[model samples]
Target: MGVFGALNAAVSGLSAQAFALENISGNIANAATVGYKRLDTSFSDLVGGGKGAQPGQIAGTVSANSRATNGLQGDLQQSQVDTYMGINGGGYFVVQGKAGEVDGRTIFSGNDLYTRRGDFEVDKEGRLVNGAGYYLMGQPIDPVTKNVSGSVPQIITIDNSVIPAVTTDRIRYEGNLPTTPQTSNQLGGGDELLDATLTKASTGAAPDAAAAGQTVGVDAINAADEVAFLNTSIAGEAITVYNSSGTPVNVQMRWAKTFEDNGTQPDTWSLYYLSDSAATGANPKWTKVSDAQFDSSAGNGGQMLVPANDAMTITGLAVDGEVVGDMTLDFGTGALTQFSDSNGSAKISKLTQNGYPSGDLAGISISEAGRLVASYSNGRTRELHEISLVSFSGEAWLERVDGGAFEVTPESGEPIAGAQGRIVGKRLESSNTDIADEFSKLIVTQQAYSANTRIVSSGDQMLQEAINMIR
Candidate 1:
């Protein structure tokens, strides 16, 4: 019985060593696989007649079990692909498997999986698919509000359709206006000289200009008036704003010093935009958009005093019949200043508009915030989806699946949102398997397997000796 037990133990030992060898070989084989987690072998001793009344018994057999290294992280490699992503700390990307296609749409398996593999790219159907054919899941974002929509993640599908045009609704302006502008009027001679009396209609107070029948047109449409107005006003920053029909219109601006502080009246200036380039008669050419009052007092200095809110609405601003709708011109607090300039021109530090023409999808990229950002051919970018990352309480207990993905097991608790790991854009995680470590295990497994065979041979010799004695 002892010999038989010894033989059984030897056979189990061989089986255990073979199991370890298989795991070692697998690890070595996947050393180059992206996001591959190494598999380790664990051994357990099985005892046969140990606790019986007959007495103590030695260990009878060995059992092998697989251990997971899913908690371990691999080195990150820089990738030229913009969508290639890598996790830095502790988390996996939530992905879904495609079961089939129905009605020109992909049918999902409904079972969520987790993986560190992020070699994803936009497929022909505009869906983000990884190299393993898994679909990346994320929360959709509202393009207008720029806010993520829901907590639950859905399969991410990019909208490759052309984005419609956005009319200019806001223009952020920041600049320093010169106290004494070197307008063409100030620098030109004779007929080119500008007449200050032909400026915008203004009351004693700067804010009263609009209320005082601002109807008095300050547009210089005639030849003499046009030359005079151009000479009197200094050029301000100009930007191209989009209209409703996706038409690009160049909005040319100018600043003219309307009123200098005469004790009672404060220093005031009028803002104008070229309304019509081909106005032949009294039709308006340059139209006054707003008035800016400056506090030129010694105590207050030269800050914007009027339009106290620092913003003005340009109602129905149009250029050459292209209506740009209404846009708010915001000059943030302290954004506008009146200072002495050698060039006597407005120094625009920031001038941007919140509008874009119709655009087609150009490219897509992953952001540091774990959001999928899409770029457009119209020089516009929009956040499409917020990438979802999930973590588990027992990462090592996850069930291994094909393509380096892991399925949830009973031991691996339900997936939790907001993982500790962050998404690294344009990078990939290499396999955690170490060739050297696998080679060392291989050598040990081979030796152990050979020793088990020797034990079997010894057991055979003992049985043969017993049989010869019987003979």
Candidate 2:
């Protein structure tokens, strides 16, 4: 029984070493795999049940079990693909296996899976799938609301459909209005004064007689009058805005300094926009939209002025006989200013309009905030979805699934739904397996297996000696 027990012990040792080798081989094999977690083998002794067992007696067998190093993080690898993503700290990407279709819609198996793998590519059906054939899941975002719509996450599908045109609704302008402008009469000759609204002096070389006589009131200035005045003003800017049909409409705007009331009020300037037809009309023209007043002493005592009300709604916009909807123009406080400068020209610091024409899908990208933004050919971007992450209390206890993914187990605890790590786009997580470490373990396992075989050979020799004594 003693010799037999020694033989059993050697056999168990051999089995334990073989199990360790298996883990080492697997780690070496998946060393280059993305998001691959290395497995570690642990050995325990199975003690004999005999009550008479002595302390020095070999009455125990070795047993081996594998535990995954799933908690270990892998190195981040940079990739050129825009959809590729990586997690910086902790957590896994929530995913699900594709399970056929229902009602002509792609359905996923009820089992929810998580993984560190992010090598996702858009398939023919416009669904993002990784190499392990798992579908990515995310929360849909409403473009209008700019918020995530649902509580539960669903499989993300790319929408490649063309986006319809959107008419201009709001325009924001930020810049400095010139305090002084070059007089129109200073340009060419007095003949040009015939087309202008200003009343010229008897002498052709003299400046505007009416402007010098009295101050122009905001109520007295009409669209046609402003257009005639801006034709020769030196302080103006032009920008191309889009219409409902995505057609480019040139909007020319100008500013003209008006007479200050009692010389105590703030400096005022009339704002104008050129009509669509007048843009290329025989003479360039404009229409007054509003008057901008600047008080340098207003708002934090800064050089900029805060208008009493800065929003102006422009209506009755016609482009080629097509009437566009009204657009609100916002000149944020401090956005528009009257500052002294040598150039005496209005400098547009910022000008943006919230409108885009119909556009084809150009590309897609993932942001650091886990948002999937789609870019359009018309130079517009829209957020489509927000990628979510799942974490576990016992991450190592997660059941290993095919494709380097894991499923929740009783030991792994419930999946925590929220963002757990910093998301990095255009990157991937490399496998945690180290080839050098795996090879070193392989050598140790080989030596231990060989030593166990020697022990078995010695045990057999002892058994033969005992049998010979009986003979």
Candidate 3:
């Protein structure tokens, strides 16, 4: 072998060794880098330069022996961008492209692309655009109503312009009015005022004319009796009502309407009571009663319920409404005319027409099926939007274009759209980098480089010996 030519062979071996070491150093430096893949360096040796080819010609010229890792597997590793979904068991979220060059026209029909990364968010446009601005494609919207009738591949938020719902537009009430017509108070001026100081009779004491010691006409007595110098005032007619159980459940009836006689019974409302003063809850339960509805007897000055001849129609003696129809109350067996006694004056407790207003926006929650719920401020919640999520069979085929978005390839197959997955708020996925594994690969590379250096040294010694023998 030629003297300088032999040295060239050693140079090739040392050069390969250097390249391997450099590759390993790079791996060590990027060990902490997310989704980084370690690389293995390959070397080639010239095999033909041993002696001359013919007798006197070189028996070996530099033929090449190549050995290396093509880095295809490394490329596969690098594809893993580290962001991992919570579950390795299955599936991942697919995001769509944003407004880009080709997508600037927005003609792609909101196609889906795959990813292992689950870090996502919604943008101002109400699209479920992740932090990368990639949209979570939802159901196809009905451009007009925005309701998803058919399958949707995306999840777009349709702002439900708040249309006020009915809170409390109506209510029913019933109660007893403690009205004592015999009391001293009068509508204008009354005889009861004058009888306050009079020493009257036991049964009929006329308040206006105490000397006429008997109660006359329909007026009540402000009975004043001072027997043997004893003085006491007795009240006039007073009225009250109670349930069948005799336990007084104070009824507060809102005025449904008032009426006048024009042969057409005048029906008009004067007041309304929204709820019972005692009842407090989201949906309070009320005692149901049809037979023993409240009304007053003809002679008694109290609230009572009497049955009617016809079974269906019962005279509703609403305590608050002005018009008291020729109604009846039924205690199952019999019926009686309701509140037919005393003056036409039936005490009415004010009724309220619903006291609540429109609801306000409260909180928002999601379901696994991608149902959006908007809670109202009035303690009422409603189902708002049904969000959709899309997936693909071959995620590796997904090409990340920009904005954390991906474009689907034919290799990715068709999009599998669904809406059963719900998002977890206030959380994120992290990169999938493995630092320890990368460092370990770097050490192996370093050892390989050292062994290659010794190989070069031994080859140099052999060439030197051959050259010395020729000298």
Q: What tens digits encode model 2's per-residue C-alpha lDDT throughout 202-278? A: 11234323334344423223333444565445456776677878887767676666544234555656676656453
1-471 per-residue lDDT for model 1 (tens digits):
999998999999999999999999899889989999999999999878758665676667999999999989999999999989999999999999999998988899999999999999988888888889899999999987989998999999999889999888999999999888887656754222235456333212232333332222254434336776777778887999999988998999888776666676667787888888887655567777877888888988789987999998888889889988888999999899887788989999999998889999999999989999999999988899999999999998999889999999899999989999999999999999989888988999999999999999999999999999989
- Cα error of candidate 3 at position 208, Å: 34
Please estimate how well model 3 matches the true structure, expressed as its whole-model Cα lDDT: 0.38
lDDT of 2: 0.76
lDDT of 3 by residue, 98-123 (tens): 54545333323455655434444434
Task: At residue 27, give the lDDT of candidate 2.
Answer: 90
Q: After superposition, how far is residue 366 of candidate 1 from its true place, in Å?
A: 1.6
Model 3 — TM-score against the truth?
A: 0.41
Point out the higher-scoring one by TM-score: 2 or 3.
Answer: 2
Give the winner by lDDT: 1 or 2. 1
Deviation in angstroms for 467 in model 2?
A: 2.9
Q: Please state the error at residue 196 of candidate 2 in Å.
A: 7.1
